[model samples]
Target: MKVSVVKIGGNIIDNVEALDTFIQQFAQLEGLKVLVHGGGKSASALMKQMGLEPQMINGRRITDAETLKVVTMMYGGLINKNIVAGLQAQHCNALGLTGADANIIEAHKRPVKEIDFGFVGDVDKVNIAPLKAFFEAGLVPVFCALTHDNQGQLLNTNADTIASQIAVGLSEAYEVSLKYCFEKTGVLMDINDESSLIAHIHQGNYSGLKADGVIADGMIPKLDNAFDAIGEGVAEVQIGKAENLLQKEFIGTSITA
Candidate 1:
C-alpha cells in the first residue's frame, strides 16, 4: 500500500485561487492520501479584529488562552471546512479533522524554558487506526494544526510537525511518501534565484549544506523534520512548490535517509 502524506502551508491557503488549484491537484494524486494544512493570516486577522494583537517569536505563534480559541475556530472550523468543501466540489471526499477529533493526535504542552509559548503543543502520538479506517472508507483526511492533551484542552501545534509524525505513524502499514509543499520550488542555494534550487539532499550532505549557509532559519527545522520522517521508515520525502504537486515527475528537492 502506498500513501502520500502531503502538507500545504500558509502560502497556498492564504490565496483563494491558489487553494482551489491545489485542491484540484490534490484530487488528482494517486492512491491513498492525506492533507495536513496550516492556518494563514486568517486567524491573526480575526484576532486583530477582536482587539487582540498577535504575538510571535522565532516564526512561531505565541498561542495564549484567548489566541487558542481563535485558532481553534479559524483552523478547525473555517479553514478546515472550506478545504473539505472544496475537495467535495472536486469529487474528492475529504473529512476535516483536528487532533481533538477521534483522538487522532495526542500532544502535550511545551514546558517553559526561556519563552513561555502558552497553549502550544508538541505532538506525542499519532493514532493510525482511525486513519486506516478513514482511508479504507475512501476518505481523504484533512487535518488542521490543532492538537489536544486528551484532557479536553486544545493546543496549537505546528502543522509541519503534525505531518511528519502522521507520516511516520502511517509507515507501519504503507509505503509512505511525505511531501512538504509550500511556495518555493525546493531548497534553494539562493532564496532569490529559483535556478539555485537544490534538487537532492540526504543525510550524507545535509550538514554540509547547513555549514555552507544554504539552509538556515525556519528551513532548518523543516529539513530536520523531513530527515526524521525519512529515518523513521517513510520511503520518500520531498519539498517543493504546491504548483508541482500532481506532476508525475517530482521537480523538487528530494530528501533521503
Candidate 2:
C-alpha cells in the first residue's frame, strides 16, 4: 500500500477559510493518508492572556508547565478536533489523535543542556501496529504535537519531527511520501523573493547552499529531518505551499539523498 503523510504549519490553523480549503483538498486525496499539524500563534496569544509569557530558542518552544497546558489545549483539543471535524464533514473518516492516546508515540523529556526546554520531548519510539490498524480499517489518523513519556507525563513535541518520525516508522509497511505544506512554495534562494524557489536539493549541494545562507533558520532543521527520513527509506519528501495538496503533480522542492 502507498501512504502520504502531510504536515501543515503557519497561520493556516488560525484562518478558517484557508484551513477549510486545505482540508477540502486533503479529503480529495486518494489512497491511505495521515495529517499532522502544528500549533498556531493562537496558543501564544492565549498564554499571554493567561499571564504566561511564551519563550522560544531558535524557533523551538521552551515549553514550561503553564505553556505545556496551553499547548495541550490548543494543539490536542482545539486544532486536532477542528481538523478532524472538517474532514468528516467532507465525507472522510478522520480520527483525531495525540501521541498519548494508544501509546502511538513514546518520548523522553529533553535533557538539560545549555538551555532547559521544560516539558519538551524527544521521540523515543513509535508503535506502528495501531497506526497500521487504522489504515486497514479505512480510518485516517490526524496527529497533534503532544506526546507522552509512557510514565504518565505528556510532553510537548515538534510537529515537524513527529511527522518525519511517523513517516520513517511506517516506511517498513508502506511506500511513504512525506509532504510539508507551509506558506512558501518551497525553499527559496532569496528570502524576500517567492520566485526564487529552489526546485530540488540533494545532499551533495546542501552544504553549499547552507554556506551561502540560502537555507538557514527553521528551514535548516526541517530539511535535516527530511533528509534523515529519506535516508531511512521514505520514498519521497516535498515541501511546498498548501495549494499543492490539491494538485495532481507535486510542486515543491524535492529532497534527495
Candidate 3:
C-alpha cells in the first residue's frame, strides 16, 4: 500500500483558516496516510501569556520543565484534538496520538552536551505495528510533537524529526512519501522573494545552497531530515505550502537522494 506522511508546521496550525483548508484537503487524499503536526509557536504564546519566557536556540525549543507542561497542554491536547475533530468533521476517521499512546514511539531524554534542552526527547524507536494496524482499520493517525521515555516521563520532541522517523519506520511496509507542509511555496533562492522557489534539490547541490546562504535557518534541519528520510527508503519527499496538496499539479521543492 502507498502511504503519505504529511507534517504540518506551526504556520498552518496557528491560523484557523489555513488549518481548516489544509485539513479539508488532507481528508480527500486517497490510500493510507498519517498527519504529524507542530504547534511550538502556539505553545510559546501560551507560555508567555502565563508569564513563562520561551527560549530557543537554532529553531529547536529549549524545553524547560515549565515549558514542557505548556507544550503538552497545547500540542498534545488543544492542537491535536482540534485537528482530530476537524478531520472527523470532514468524514475522516482520525485518531489523535502522542508517543505515549500505545507506546507507538519510545524516546530518551536528550543528553546534555553544549546545551541542555530540558525535557527534550530524542526518538529511540518508532513502533510501526500499531500504526499499520490503524491503517488497516481504515483510520488516519494524527501525531503530536510529544514523546515519552516509557518510564513515566513525557518529553517534547521535534515534530519534523518525528515525521521523518515515522516515515522511515513504515517504509518497510508502504511506499511512503513524506510531505512537509508549511506557509512557504518551497525552499526559496532569496528569502525576501517568495517567487524564487527551488523546485528541485539533491544532495550534490544542497551543500552549495547552504554555503550560499540560500537554505539557512530552520529550513536547514528540515531539509537535512528530508534527505535522511529519502536515503532510508522513503519513496519521495517534498516541501511546500499546505495549499500545494490541493493542487492538480504539485509545485514544491522535491528532494532527491
Candidate 4:
C-alpha cells in the first residue's frame, strides 16, 4: 500500500480558517494516510491564559510539567479531536490518537543536559502493528504531539519528529510519502521570495544549500528529519504549504537521497 503521512504546522492550527481549509484538503488526500499536527500555538495561548509564561530554548519549547498539562488538554484533547471531527464532517473516517493510545508509540523523557527540557519526550519506538491495523481497516489516524513512557507518563513530543518517525516506521510495510506542510511554498533560496522555491533537493546539494545559509535555523532540523526519513527507506519526502496538499500537479521541495 502507498501511504501519506502528512504533518500540519502549529501556525495553521492556530488559525481557525487555515486549519479548516487544511483539513478539507487533507480529507481529499488519496490512499491510505495519517495526519500529525503541531499545537504549540494553542498550548502557548492556553499557558498564557493560565498565567504561565511560555519559555523556549533554541526554538524548541521548554515543556515543563505545567506546560505538559496544558499541551495534553490542547494538543491531545482539543486540537486532535477538532481535526478528527472536521475530517468526519468532510466524510472521511478519522481516528484521533496519541502515542499512548494502543501503544502506537513509546518515548522516553529527554534527558537533562545543560538545559532541562522538562517532560519533553524524544520518540523511542513506533509500533506499526496498530497503525497497519488501522490502515487495513480503512481508517485514517490523526495523531497529536503526545507520547507515553510505558510507565503512565504522557510526555510532550515534537510533532515533526513524530511524523517523520511514523513515516519511517510505516515504510517497512508500505510505500511511504512523508510530507511536511507549513506556511511556505517550499524550501526557498530567499525567505522573502516565494518564486525562489527550491523545487527539488537531494543529498548532493543539501549541504551546499545549508552552507550558503539558504537552509538555516528551524528549517535545518526539519530537513534533517526529512533526510533521516529518506535514509531509513521512506520512498518520498516533500515540504510545502498545506494548501497544495491535494493538487493534481505537485508543487514543493522534493527531498531525495
Candidate 5:
C-alpha cells in the first residue's frame, strides 16, 4: 500500500468554496492513503476577532502562553473539526488528531533564547504507531500540528515542521510519496514571475538558488522542510498549486535525493 502525505496550506483553507472543490477532488484519488496537516488562517482570524493580535517571528507564530491557548483552540479545535467534517461528508473516513494523541508526535518545549516566544515546540520525535493503526484501518489521519513535551504541556509547533515530521514518519512506516500543496505552482526562479517554476532541484543547487535570491519568503521554509524530508528518506517532495492537484504529472518543483 502506498501512503501519501498532503499538506494543505492556510491560504487554501481561507477560500471556502475553493477548499470544498479541492476536498471533492482529493476524495476521488484512487486507492490513496492520505494524511493532511493544516495551518491557522481561520485561527488567526478568530484571534483577531477576539481582539488578540497574532504575532509572527521568522515566519512562525510567536506563541506565548496566552497565544498558545488561542492557537490550540483555533487550529486543533475549530479548523481540525471543520475539515474532518467536510471530508466525512464526502464519505471519507478522515480522523482528526493532534500530535499529542497517542504521543503520535513528541516535542520538547524549546527554551527561550533570543526569541521570547512562549510554549513554542520543536518536534524531537514522532511515534507512527497510532497513525499506522488509523491508516491501516482505512482512515485518513488529519493532524493539526499541536504537540507536547515530557510534562505533557501543549506546545505550538510550526505547521510546515509538522507536515515535514508527518512525511518523515509516514515514510519510515511505509513507502510513501509526500506532496506539499500551497498557493504557488512551485519554487520559482523569479519571485514576481509565476511562470518560472523550477522543474527540478537538487541538494547542492538549493543553496545556490537561495543565495541568488530565487527562493524567498515563505517558499524558503517550505523548501527546507521538503529537503529535510527527502534527506530523511521520503521519496519525493512536490510543491505545487491547489487546483492542479489532480494532474498525474507534477507541475511544481521536484525535490529529489
Candidate 6:
C-alpha cells in the first residue's frame, strides 16, 4: 500500500473553487492512502468577528485561556469537520480527528526560553496506532493540530509543524511519501517572481538562503518544517500546488536526503 500525506493550508481552504478542484483530484486517485492536516483560518476569522482579538508571537498564534477555547472549538471542531465534509461531498471517505483520538498524538505544553505563550504545545510524541487502524480500514484521516496531554487538557500546536510531524510519523509507520501542499509552488529565488521556483534544494543551501534573507517570514518556518520532515526519514518532501498532485513535470522544490 502506497501512502501520500498532504498538508493543506488554511488560506487555501478559504477559497471555494480551489478547495473543490483539489478535492476532485484527490477523489480521482485510485488505491492511494491519504492523510490530511488543515489549519484554522475560518476559526480565527470567527474569533475576530466575535471581537476576540487573536495575538501572535513569532508567527505562532498566542493561545491564552480565552483564545485556546476558541481555537480548539474552531480548529478542531468546525474546521476539521468542514474539511471532512468537503471531501465526503466528493465521495471521499474522510474521518476528521484530533490528537485526542486513540491518543493519536501527545504533547507537553511548550516552554519557550525566550517567550511565554500560554497553552501552546510542541508535539512530544505521536501515537500512530489509531492512524494505522483508520488507514487499514480504508478511511482517510484528516487532522487538526490541536492535541492534549494524558490529563486531557487541550493545547495548541503549530499546524504546519504538527502536519510535518504527522507526515514523518505516517512515513515511518507505513513507509510512503509525504507531500506538503500550500499556496506557493515552492521556495522561490526571487520572492516576487512566481516562475523562480527552485526545483531542487540541498539542505546546505537552505540555511544560507535564510541567513541572506532569500527565505524569510512565513517561508522560513515552512522551509524549517520541510527540512525537519526530510531529516526524519521521509522518503522525499515536495512543496507544491494541489493542482499538480504527483505529476512528475509539475514545478516545486524537492528536499532529498
Where does the lowest 10-residue lDDT sum fall in candidate 2? 242-251
lDDT of 5 by residue, 1-257 (tens): 66777778777777888788878767766555564656637767877888988888897678877688887887788888988898899988988888888888899888778987788788999888888788668888888878988686998887777878877887876766777787877888876788988988888798898898888887777677788888898888777886665566558878887
Off by over 4 Å in 2: 55-60, 211-213
Better of 3 and 6 by TM-score: 3
Q: List candidate 5 segments past 4 Å from native.
A: 55-60, 204-213, 216-218
Who is ahead in lDDT, 1 or 6?
A: 1
- Candidate 2, 1-257: lDDT as tens digits: 89999998866888889999999999999999999999889799999899888899987789988899999999999899989999999999999999999899999999999999999999999898999999889999999999999999999998999999999999999999899998888989988888899988988999999999889998998899899999999988989897875578877888877
> All models: lDDT?
0.93, 0.91, 0.91, 0.90, 0.79, 0.76
Q: Which regions in candidate 3 have their CA more than 4 angstroms from the true location? A: 55-60, 204-218
RMSD of each: 1.4, 1.8, 2.0, 1.5, 2.3, 2.5
Cα lDDT, model 3, residue 241: 85
What stretches of model 4 exceed 4 Å from their correct place?
A: 57-59
Colliding residue pairs in candidate 4? none
What would the TM-scores of all predictions be? 0.95, 0.93, 0.92, 0.95, 0.89, 0.87
C-alpha-based local distance difference test score of model 4: 0.90
Give the Å error, residue 113, model 5.
0.1
lDDT by residue for model 6 (24-60), tens: 7776655545645565377678788889888888886
TM-score pick, better of 4 and 5: 4
Model 5 TM-score, 2 decimals: 0.89
Off by over 4 Å in 1: 57-59
